[model samples]
Target: MSIFVRLLEAIGIASASAPPIASRPAPVGPIMAYNALDLSDPGLLEMMRDGRIGVSGLSVNERQALRNSTFFRAMNLIAGSIGKLPIHLMRRNGKLTEKASEHPLFNVLHRKPNDYQTASRFKSYMQLAALLDGSAYALKIKSRGAVRQLIPLARRSVKPQLSDDFVLTFRYTRPNGTVVTLQADDVFHFSTPLSLDGLNGVSLLDVAADTLGLTIKAQQAAARLLTKGTMARGALQTEATLGEEAIAHLKQSLAEGYAGANAEHDWLILEEGLKANAFGYNAKDSQLIELMKREAEEVSRFTGAPRPLLMFDETSWGSGVRELGLFLVTYCLMDWFVIWEEAIWMWLLTPEEQKTFYAKFNEGALLRGSLKDQADFFKAALGPNGAWLEPNEVRESFDRNPIEGGEGLPRSGTTAAAIAQADKPDDKEGSENGA
Candidate 1:
């Protein structure tokens, strides 16, 4: 009977048999029509203004926060680093493990998850959503009792519901006004580490909204200073008082003569005894730059990204860059990797399969050093003193095809003849008598 119920009914969510609002669980809260309804509707606008609808009341908008250069760079750096890495489905056989390439889900994870998106693009999109919106979701399209495709769902459009029986479901409102209720097993959900109730994750953006607001405000102030600040190249001053009409005319004349890129080098003509005074960079301007830098540092700290990776500092080509890369992997990416792996086990793999199968993000690419350093590492791995890595295994790391007889580990000071001679049993009497 209420406007909210009517709106829900109009969107094909509420029906005659639907339970009354008071009877529903309290913690589920009101179903927010986030961008699902016509926002231009006056009734909707009224509800939003009156706080009847739970539209995002973020102090800083998520999209606007991304517009900041430092925030964008930090997000891109973290998301891209996770995206570019290869995620594989691996099976453990005792102490040995190998890529489960033959599994149906393996291709979905490694190469293509769906028809429209590659693994990299899909992972990147999910990572961005998780970082920005606190959670990410994908509907698992299954075929023949196995997952076939993963369709991404908008974070805002999907509402999570948990019942008293500990069962979970998702009420997803699509763009076309259709509402679909999905089971917990049918959706792949990834949440941020900061979860209070253990069912939903807290948004990092929302948690750091005040800081992001300051960053956005600082950026806007800098823009205003550049466009309308008194630190311009020069300004006109007059000793004689002038009428409003005269002042308007002088302002128009100055703008027409020297406003844009075309008038940058044009000479200003002095009229009515007006004098021009040049301006230089002042302490205030320097302070603004420092303020922006400090805000960037704050954002970097929130994202757990190193300042160097965010382009705040200059890292040399070899070791400096390598160390930073390692730091990023250890501090920032490792947790994300574990999150994805555990989520995959929970949502993608079956109970029996989870015992032997697992997902892993191969971060070797990000942690790789220079060519020489890699060579030395591989050399040490394949060394004779208790060689743990096979020649073919090292080649596989380099993306080279395995060669014949490369599976076995090599030993130093050992040749085919030496091996054959060593294999032969020696007669002690023959050796001592020189027979």
Candidate 2:
């Protein structure tokens, strides 16, 4: 079997038997049609041939890319951010909105998505898969016309097919090597915004292969350097021309006596008036730190994560933590939120429910600041002057239970009873005020 086929099998994707290229049908719809000759499809051919190998000669598939620290950190930042936030199924009643707790999807999205995974964990896994593979798929197991459980599928295991009439089908390979074709409504697909054919999302790993490859190479170089005790290659100079035997003996001596970490500090013992002349650049000369920083920035740019969040000491868009966090939410996570919300509406909500019910990630928690700042914000929200939020609303934000009579917005200072008696309006003024 080919390495590509092995890789596919390793990831639970079963490769189909190939027919002759001449007998294959023409490309149709937005999906890339594959002929018996995989080489006919440029994208698939590239993946099979190059396996996303970079200029640095490093393979940069999703798993390989995640091995880089910067890439892993960025993925974790995005996935964790989406995971920790609460998602709600909200219902709209004219101008008012409230959580649709009675909806079947409410518990599946907010509390537990499946018997084994909590909502947070499922979201994190899905987000991570989407970020890595450019698309994430989950089976929407329904009961009584309502989705009851969501089972995530391996990205490689599911193949999407679009018919000429715009019907979508998913061919999924189970762990037991069984292939089952499912309709559009049976699957929940979330893809990144960048797409050429609309039906499938492009993988970020493939797009940023060169950058990530260089990063992995740089990391390997650093590891090798550390293993060699930060040593640089040098030449042993001698006035006398060395014979082949002498050179071999000298090379062996260097390798056995002074090559690795244990012999790093050992003094070189040279004979016959030989001198050590350093030639190649050391880690400092090569600017490894600067290279790593550039790679980190590249990862941040590609993953839409702030550099500061990746543990870079430099200041990002804002100086304060709250501003930086806001930057992350607004720039990095908002698109993902929209993707999830729209996907939910598309796959989970019925046509009648779509008009009134929608999904939303409550990002208010991520935007919150320190305790003092939160207190001031709640106070202002519940203040008497044009009070917009009830006391119970503020308490709910803090995860506190509502007290009796805390549901109403208190217009204390603005009330007629609180107004000064001297400032009280006369009969005509009072009538106008009441009007």
Candidate 3:
């Protein structure tokens, strides 16, 4: 009785222990990472709209680099967002001007003329033109220094000694535990006009249909918003109601629960991380900037990458403007690997399309052709891990180039060029070997 019965029980136990051979799909364990954006997931594209996802911000340089790559369109979508500042302030105080675009104040900042500048500077000037449409910018705070009057309005500011050097700069940590050092002058580049195709991972139609049916819904809501006043254009309302709708669309797309926004949530987590490293929150000082600043020390480090000490001659808004968060957005969109991974609206492209994608993502071709020495400098900015710059070293290096505007030019065109040259070597060696 015992031996046969025991053997049968053992067999039963063994059968139970093994995985079910051909059963219906069973529930898996909890999801721990950014699987919402996973392409293999059945509803990935559809989920992109349903408030379960969002696109991340891409930088200016990276966006342009991947403009023609497979991910370019998706990146544009991820990066586009709406920021709601006290919108009333925009009406009563801010002017409707193309400050960054047509009237980019950076163009007013002169540099020692060179081939790169003569060519590249014009491109920046055009960028300002595209963004602003030529409107005078309001000077937020008048900086003064004896160097203020330098010709071409070089970065020399003529600030009275009385003005406190209050804007602080420091290094911070990101959610992924990466380091990003930020200077006080680093601009947040709020979700103003996120029209560039930086977010190519998900489709806009998919996002609109999902997140509150937001694209069309936002347009309808913004169109209906009673809130309106003097805008920068000297118009009688806040941004054209449609413009407000677009921004709202953008902001909601980035907030928690937006599909493809797993990266953004991670970034915010990084910002909060700053709280552990330094001064405690004053909670009492409720100023928005102060509130934001309370979070800033931490934010700076979380998005931290090494700032390169570029060889330009400006400081105020030059290399010091664009910080680490923005750069991540830029690089991710233009990154060769990421773009190549998502080829053609989920269809996967042929080999020829991959070639074109690689070419566009490789900005080195343009840089090397224009400036050899400058290409070398760009190579130096790249970190050992292929990052545009090291988390710690970036701050000081990019400071050297002439900072015109159009997402603010780097001081070192040479640095950018240097990286480009190394990325793609000359085929001259192959020719020599053949000979």
Candidate 4:
């Protein structure tokens, strides 16, 4: 253990063990249900475990609903895109030299963090937070005097409580139920602030709560329709009086024979004068499908994720997909990238180091256009009026090695002639004067 940890332990500020069952008392005040100030609230952990959402009208848990819905998959795609990209530190002069680029800071970032998580895992964790919870948090683990590792904190594991002095402190609960009190500086927080509590972020669930609730209700209704037989709606009519056993047998047989997708085309026979009379067959089916479509589209619209991404809008295809993809990167993903970049710079780097170095996400990886688009872009970039990037830079985009003599730009005739004339300045001036 580090001296810092030992010092904290000595001062009785270290993480305390989980209290005994009898020792834990009932909470009080407005935060009575789950004490926001306390890290290891059993109620909080139980809510997380059950995936319970207090938001009314939702039949399902927020986390489960997000996973089951297309929005979660779209979020995964966005998160994965960012997580796979190279995020590195650049020097003040904008060069990525060995000293600046391959610093220990970057090594900790790109390699295993605290000997447990991979670089990709770390980035993905933050990405998930930015998308779903509107915040990402990390515990800054230090070795000696310098910051060494960053451990990503689960969104459900930590709660940020604001004191009367307007100071922020984190109440983090470990997996073993140990609650640790950490100062704001000890935790790295990246938040998309929508309220006064800048430490905690607004959940996407909270924003799309009503819509999600409606979605769940719609899904439940559809499941009921399917389980009760999609085509076999309405009631069974009979002229002859039936006994309780006969009615029970008939109900069971109908349910087993025609109830789910697997029993769709099965023969549903009603003996003993019991006739099956179906109602709302066509209208209900169409309405159910339409309701689902509308709900999915609503989710897409509210979340800023494209409807086409969730396969709800077939109209947006080909070039429209590309346009939407670019739009998503610019509007949705770019904002998230900035949140992460700024947080990393502020939290990871010391005040002095922040001046010399800054962290940036490689947006080019996310925004790279089509082959034709890239060709045109590179052509314009290498043109006489453009600031020509080296051939190695272009080759790197194509995942190819640089060729010898490819560093120099292919000069235009006008540029070459201008250069030649400029070299012979005296001759050029004399010729102009004689003329």
Give TM-scores for every candidate, taking all chains together and pairing residue i with residue i.
0.73, 0.75, 0.18, 0.70
Query: Highest TM-score, which number?
Result: 2
State the TM-score for model 1: 0.73
Instruction: Give candidate 4 misplaced runs (Cα > 4 Å).
Output: 1-56, 94-99, 144-146, 164-166, 230-280, 283-286, 318-321, 408-410, 413-435
Worst 10 residues of 4 by lDDT: 29-38
- Which residue ranges in model 3 land beyond 4 Å of their true spot? 1-287, 294-337, 345-360, 365-372, 375-435
Cα lDDT of model 4 by residue, 56-114, tens digit? 44434456566546677667767786788767766676453323645667776666666
Descending-lDDT candidate ranking: 2, 1, 4, 3
Q: Between prediction 3 and prediction 4, which has the larger TM-score?
A: 4
Question: lDDT (0-100) at residue 248 of candidate 3?
Answer: 68
Write candidate 1's Cα lDDT for 42-75 as tens digits. Answer: 5455334431211233356667778878889988
> Against the true structure, whose lDDT is highest?
2
Clashing pairs in 2: none
lDDT of 2 by residue, 35-154 (tens): 122445565555565458778887677778778788889888889989999999999999999999999899999998999999989999999888777789999999988999999997
Global lDDT of each model?
Answer: 0.79, 0.80, 0.29, 0.68
RMSD of 2: 9.5
The lDDT, on a scale of 0 to 1, for candidate 4 is 0.68
lDDT of 2 at 218: 82
In model 2, how large is the Cα lDDT of residue 377? 68
lDDT digits (tens) for residues 247-340 of candidate 3: 5654475454444645634422222112213323332332333433333232223212222211112323323223322443354323422332
After TM-score superposition, the amount by which residue 32's alpha carbon in candidate 3 deviates from its true location, in angstroms, is 36
